[model samples]
Target: MAKALMIQGTSSGAGKSLLVTALCRIAKNLGFKVAPFKAQNMSLQSFITKNGGEIGLAQALQAMSAGLEPEIHMNPILLKADGNKGSQVIIHGKVYKTLKPKEYYAEKKKLWNKVLESLEYLKKHYELLIVEGAGSPAEINLRDSDIVNMAVAEYLKAPVILVGDIDKGGVFASLYGTIKLVGKSEKLIKGFIINKFRGDVEILKPGIREIEKLCQKPCLGVLPYFEELSLSSEDSLGLSYHKTFSSEKNKLIKIVVLRLKYISNFSDFDPLKYEPDVELLYSLRKEELLSADVVIIPGSKRTVEDLLWLKSLKIDKILKYLAEKGVEIIGLCGGFQMLGKILKDPEKVESDLKEIKGLGLLDIETTFYPKKITTQAEGYCNLKENLKIWGYEIHMGESEGDLNLFTIKRFATKEIKKEGSQKESIWGTYLHGIFENDDFRRFILNKVREKKGLTPLEKSYSYKKLREITFNTLAKLVETHLNMEKIWSLIKL
Candidate 1:
């Protein structure tokens, strides 16, 4: 087995994911081929691979840092939240089933064989594997069948690096309590790092010394919060996500997404955030979205509930205003389902809400279906704006609308256009990350300009360049705190 160091946390959002990412980058910088593994991940933020698989965005970031193509082996199990105490379970890039909390707990223990298989795959191939745990393993109630945190590290015999978020307070207590809670002080915990700290370093040294003494663990480093890195977050919850911009300057394209409760895959717009002059804004207030050059409706876990919620808050009126003002409107995935004549969940795929009326901007009707189309598809996109783009489709509904307006050609293994878009200023599609394609990206950027009666910006984007920049920053972050030589030694052993 390759040497390994697991980065576990006292709780969720303790900066474990970012630490793993930086470590992977730093390892690559030190000439070690490193890979990241998470035995289990329960989060809403997900990534669609070029090969049509799904995994958490955190592992994908780690893979990028390691200079490797993201694969299903990185995150063997991705549990996507589906609201009301349920999650869609994904095992090795395949949808296993939709399981309620209790139901999932029962099956998780049985899934360890598969988790071990993925870990072994990485262990044999990569020089090192940086593992991450799910939520706090300290939930004593959940210790019996702990598949994510302490259980996985113990299974792999990997030394643990406990990460605590001091910004939340109780740093010493959290570290001490976590070790006590796990009830296993085998001296396998190599060290610790304090993440998301603010203020003078001199003052924090005392706290760091105190933390080391209280936990009886080496204080590896105290990492101050740095916002300039522009690190893309793995989960939307409490994440400081920024939009991407192009190096070539141009007029700003202000695209505003309405932030709703229970948002599912809002990361679909992360690519857009990087666009130069394309200001991506997320608004929950109706008035705040009015001045946006383009109004977007992102996917929601509960489409019916969110639509009803939007209707209650007059989001329909605001969308209508943006449309009337000649502003561009784009609806993606679940958002596309809501833009049709009606979003009926007779089959209850998304929710139990019988049927809800849509915005009717696309002249389409969506029916919640029993079957899910979780496959990769590609094609051209041109309407009020001309663009040829490629993207992936994973949705649970059938849509019917004007096909001529928005032409869709799925790449492989399926022929279905249950949901689609319009040709005019308004467009809708049940596809996520389709804008990542250059042709599609150019079209949308130009359409935003077209809506504003402006010319398309000639400056283009380099996707590879952006990835490199992100990875480089992450590597520096690791070098700043982690012991690269020690981590590499762990990975090799």
Candidate 2:
């Protein structure tokens, strides 16, 4: 067994992802081949790996911290909520089908084996594997077959450093109660860490002393509340964005994103947001999307349903406006489904609907197929002049675009792999996380600037450089908050 440590949280949103990233950054700095693993994670936000499997975005960020390309083993199980009552569950980087509340829990027990398979694979490959637990291990009802927390730890025989959110109050109870309720036989959970504390360090001394005295575990130390870490939210919750710098002087281009009910992979907007002189905003209401310079439809879990939402929101008018104005309107994955002529769901993968009218921006039709096309692709943008770029493609429905209006060339190893149809000003592709590529990202930014009649900035932030900035900020957080020596002591190798 590789020397392992499990960082479990007292509850959801208790700084678990952040803590795991710290451990990852710190471990790498110590010259250890470290990796981040979360057996299972339930969140509205999800990511598609290179192989076309979805994992938690937090694990993806953690993988970035560890200098490893994102993969499915880092997060074996990803639960994307189709709605409050149901979720699209991806197990072992494969879709096991959608399940409602009762059905999900019924089959939940069987997924532990897949989780173990991934952990076993990681244990063999890495010098240190920092595992992160979902929600809380202390939730007694979920403790029996819980694979994300104690169950995962027990299987690997990894030690745990449970984290408590002091900023949320009840830190003492949360810390003490978690240890009191969790299975004592897991042989995990050797210590505890108090996080997000504010005010003086001296004030937390008594509480830390009391927690250690009661739980009989060492207190790793309290992390003071620091909020300057410019990181992406794994799930689009508890996030507030402000237009710190105005875009009026820079660019007149406006990107209107259709904020659908079950939007899955909205992180595609991160690159757009990172671009200078570009205003990336989402319209929750129908009227907000009208008169957009570039109307973008993001990926959705329920394409047909979100299309209905798009109509109700009157996004069709915005698409028409962009199309008539020669605006660059693009759709990705499920969004690509909506840009087509029609969407057919005969298999009822999403709904019982057979066919529905689409925006018809791109000359195309999509059919929901049984087998999903999940893979990485290298290509150049099929603009008036091709630009070299590479991006991943993750989508279930197959899109056939019209030859006259929309065109894209898929390349692999300096050769043409496949060709995409082009139609008019509308572009559609079955790629989810494409804009993350620097050249493609720059193309979008520069094009948007030209459309808006503004000159693009000379200083462009490359995605690789942006990741360095984000990762380095996270490293700083680790240096200030976590006890580096204590965490290093926990790594077995």
Candidate 2 TM-score to native: 0.89
Q: Please, what are the lDDT tens digits per residue for candidate 2 over residues 266-332?
A: 7777777766566667775545455566777788878888899878867687678768878778787
Off by over 4 Å in 2: 185-187, 226-230, 244-252, 384-386, 403-424, 491-493
Q: Against the true structure, what is each candidate's TM-score?
A: 0.90, 0.89
Worst 10 residues of 2 by lDDT: 405-414
TM-score of candidate 1 to 2 decimals: 0.90
The deviation in Å at residue 182 for candidate 2 is 1.2
Backbone clash total, candidate 1: 14
- Evaluate all candidate structures by whole-model CA lDDT and list the values in order: 0.75, 0.74
